[model samples]
Target chain A: NAGVTQTPKFRILKIGQSMTLQCAQDMNHNYMYWYRQDPGMGLKLIYYSVGAGITDKGEVPNGYNVSRSTTEDFPLRLELAAPSQTSVYFCASRGTGGADTQYFGPGTRLTVL
Target chain B: DQQVKQNSPSLSVQEGRISILNCDYTNSMFDYFLWYKKYPAEGPTFLISISSIKDKNEDGRFTVFLNKSAKHLSLHIVPSQPGDSAVYFCAGGKDTGRRALTFGSGTRLQVQP
Candidate 1:
């Protein structure tokens, strides 16, 4: 299985611009998450989905949105991107079991100027 | 507030030596702790995990120890190899609800051969 995969390995956006970060998992996980890691900072959850059509805000959800329309896909949208949004974004997925191990994608490096 | 913290930004160890990485969490609600390792340009991968009920868990050359009194957890790698060089992240989470993990800033380990 390809496990989890994220599109746009690297991207740079101007202030006020908008874009979507795409994520997909072949494992058919019931949970998917979006997280951003700033330089010298830990990864903070932006949004997550328990299942298709079920999304929730996380630790840092400002300036971002997410939707899980299918069990295999979860996409993150950034409206009016700001410099503060510059960071490495990671996508992860996990099964519904009690185990806390989340499989992560290669991640997308995003820069907003 | 930062729920999870990895105080050391980086660590270096000689080949065949032992490497110990530490993590602390502020929330007592966190019952599950995990460690992830990431290579440059790659996403983080699951290394090991420990539950609150267990004081330690071992897998191959890696071991995780949890000290509930101190609200601390650690990962130990015996006979560290150059191939083990990577950024290690420690995370904590609750077993109930959505089970979202709070991650540390990460510690870059350089295994010198």
Candidate 2:
């Protein structure tokens, strides 16, 4: 089974443009997260969802929004792309139980010009 | 400020040697520490983890040592192999109902065979 899948392996966007990064997991996990990694930097959490219909902001949630419509899908939306938002975006999922290991998807690389 | 820190930007080790990756955190509220490994163009994968109550945890060829008083942790990989070369990230989790992770800037590890 595909544990976690992310769409748009690479993308380029102009300033003020908007796009959505698609993420889906087949593991039926209740916890899903969106994170962005800048060059030579660690991943920073953007937004997270504990379950469908519930979403919350994370450390770096300034220019992004998230929606968890179903147990399988959690998409990240960039309202107004900026140069600072050019980074690799990763999606991860984990079970609801205590300290479950997180499974990550192949990241989406976005370049904002 | 970055709560977690990986001071070394990169490390090089010969095949069959030991590779040690260090991480320190400024937050005492973090009760769990984890290590993730990432290759180019791929998302980070969970490698090993240790709880505050445990001083050390071993998984096959990898070992994680945690020093709660020092707010430091390390990953030791014995007999380092060429395939083990990648960026290693240190992450911490604070269990305040939400298992959110804070990551440090990764340390790139190069193993020469």
Cα miss at A61, model 1 (Å)? 0.8
In candidate 1 chain A, what residue range of length 10 has the lowest lDDT sum? A92-101
Candidate 1 per-residue lDDT over residues B1-113, each given as its tens digit: 98899999999999999999999889998878899999989999999999888999999999999999998899999989999999999998776777788999999999999
The clash count for each model shown is: 0, 0
TM-score, model 1 to reference: 0.98
| CA error at residue B40 for candidate 1, angstroms | 0.9
The whole-model lDDT of each prediction reads: 0.93, 0.93
User: Which parts of model 1 have CA positions greater than 4 angstroms off?
Assistant: none
Give the interface RMSD of each candidate: 0.7, 1.2
Ten residues in sequence with the least summed lDDT for candidate 1 chain B: B92-101
Candidate 1 per-residue lDDT, tens place, A1-113, comes to 99999999999999999999999999989999999989888889999999999999998999999998999999999999999999999999998888648999999999999
- Report how large a share of the reference interface contacts model 2 reproduces: 0.67
